[model samples]
Each structure stands twice: as C-alpha cells, then as structure tokens.
Target: MKDAEKLAAFCATIADERKADNIVQLKLADISTVTDFFILCTANSEPHLRAIADTIVRDAREKLKVRPRKVDGKPASHWIIIDYTNVLIHIMTNEMRELYQLESLWGDAPTVSAIKTLRKKTPA
Candidate 1:
C-alpha cells in the first residue's frame, strides 16, 4: 500500500485498540490540499481521548517510526487533531463529532470501509 493508506490504516488500528467508536477514513487527496486522508473516531470521554491519542503517538514512534508534524486540541477538549502531513487524525467526543460533522463536510471524498474488514482479508 501507499504511504497515505498505510498511515491511515495504522492510525485507525491505534484508535480501535483504544476502543474508539465510529472510526471512518476519508480519501481527501483528490479534493483537498490539507491531507490525503482523514481518520476520524469518537471517544467516550476525556480520558478515553487521552488513551487514544497517547497510544497513537507512542505506537507510531516506537513501531512505525512516524510522528505527527503537529497536534492540536487537548484531552480536555472535545476534539483532538494529530497531523502527520499526509494523514490527519481526529479524535472527538460524540457531541463534538456531531457538531462538526466532518464526514458530512467531506461527503464528496470516498469513504474507506471498516479497518477490521481490511485486516480480515490480510493473512496474519
């Protein structure tokens, strides 16, 4: 897979490991300049957001050798954004996700199916 797809899939796995809900990956390369993909997931609370964000950082650094160019928002906030240049990750509470409706905003971008489906197709 390409770097963008690899990065997005990796991030999605990290989010799933942390019990993030409604994970969605959007292919934004064709339509946006900001990033190639957006990995969005919903967290249950601030601590849950922290767990997801912290593990993404730790695992990406220790395992993937990749780090976010920039990170925005905080665990206390409703949303947290991790920017990896080619891929962007958003972890948010249900309320914030509903308010922003990023999936709706980027409706034109093609949506990648659940990561679990992708994992299942690949042999362990």
Candidate 2:
C-alpha cells in the first residue's frame, strides 16, 4: 500500500481502538486537491472525541513516525480535524457528524476499507 493509505489505515486502527463509531476512510484524491484521503469517525461524547483524536495523533506519531501538520476544532466544539498533509482525520460527536454530513458532501469519493487494511497489516 502507498504511504498515505498506510497512514489512513493506521489512524483508523487507532480510532477503532478508542471505540470510535462509524469509522470511514474516503478516497478524495480524484475529487479534491486539499487532501488524498479523509478518515472520519463519530465519538460518543466530548471526552470520547478528545480521546479518539489524541490517540490517533499520538499513536500515529509514535508508531508510524508521522504527525499531523495541523489540528483544528476542539472537543468542546464536538469536532476535531487533524491534518496530516495528505490525509485528514475528523473526529466528531454524533450530533456534529450529523450536522456536517461530510460523507454526503464527499459522496462522489470512494470509500476505502481502512479497518480491513489495518487487520491485514496486524499480526494475529
């Protein structure tokens, strides 16, 4: 897999470990110039949102040697956006996620099986 794909999968895995809901990785390379992939997931609450975002950032840096170039939003806002140059991670509460509906906004972009990719890379 490509570096960005691997990073996306790795971020998804970290989010899953934090019990993030509705995890999705969207391939935006063909449709958008802003980023290549977008990893979006819903958190149960503000603390959950913080945990998911923090874990993704921390683990991605420690394990993959990658850190987001920027992080936007906050737990209190019910949304957090971590920008890793080629991949963007969105951690949001259900309400925020519903309101934004990023999936619908990027409907034309294809979804990638990020969890499956992580599982394949992980040893049982």
Candidate 3:
C-alpha cells in the first residue's frame, strides 16, 4: 500500500482502539485533490472525541513520525478534522455524522478496506 493508504489504515485502527463507531475510509485520490483518503469515525461524546484525537496524533507522531499539517474543529464541537496532507480524518458525534451524511455525499468514492487486516499486522 502507498504510504497515504497505510496512514489512513493506521488512523482507522487508532479510532477503533478508542472505541470510535462506524469507522470508514473513503479513497478520494481519483475524485478529489483535497486529500487522498478520508478516515472517518463517530465518537460517543466530547471526551471520547478528544481521546481518539489525542491518541491518533500521539501514535502517528511516535510510531510513524507523522503529524497532521492542520487540525480543524474542537473536541466539544463534536466534529473534528485532522488533515495530514495525504490523509484527512473526521471524528464526529453520531448526530453530526448523520447530519453531514458524508458517505452519501461521496457516493462515488470507493470505500477502502484492509484496515482491520493492517491493524492485525502492525503493533500498537
């Protein structure tokens, strides 16, 4: 896998570890210039959102020597976005996720799998 795709899978695994719900990765390379992959998951609450965000940042930096170029939205906002140039992560509350309906909005984008498999191969 490309580094971006591997990073996406890593972020997805981090979300899963933090108990984020409905995790999904949308491959946007063919359709968008904004980013390569969108790793999205739903957080249960403000604290949960913060925890997931923190873990991703810390783990990515420590494990992969990677960091997001920019991070948008606050933990309390219930919808935070972490942009890593090649990959973008969306951590949202259930309500915000439902409201945005990103999956439908990006219906043409293909969902990327193998994250679960990747998680198994990589150490935490």
* Model 3 lDDT on a 0 to 1 scale: 0.88
Q: Please identify model 1 stretches exceeding 4 Å from their true place.
A: 115-124
lDDT of 1: 0.88
Which consecutive 10 residues in model 3 have the weakest lDDT in total?
113-122
For model 2 the local lDDT of residue 48 reads 84
lDDT of 2 at 49: 92
- Position 27, candidate 2: lDDT: 95
Give the distance in Å from residue 78's predicted Cα in candidate 1 to where it truly belongs.
1.2
The residue-by-residue lDDT of candidate 3 on 1-124, one tens digit each, is: 3999899989999898887888999999999988899988888889989999999999999999998999899987899999999998999998999999988988889998633321223576
Instruction: Give the per-residue lDDT digits (tens) of candidate 2, residues 28-116.
Output: 99999989999998888899898888888888889889878999998899999999999999988889889989999999999996442
Residue 96's lDDT in candidate 2:
88
Q: How well does model 2 score by local distance difference test?
A: 0.87
lDDT of 1 by residue, 11-108 (tens): 99889888788899999999999889999999889998988998998899898899899999998888999999999999999999999898899999
lDDT, model 1, position 76: 81
Q: Tell me the spans in candidate 2 whose CA falls farther than 4 Å from its real position.
A: 114-124
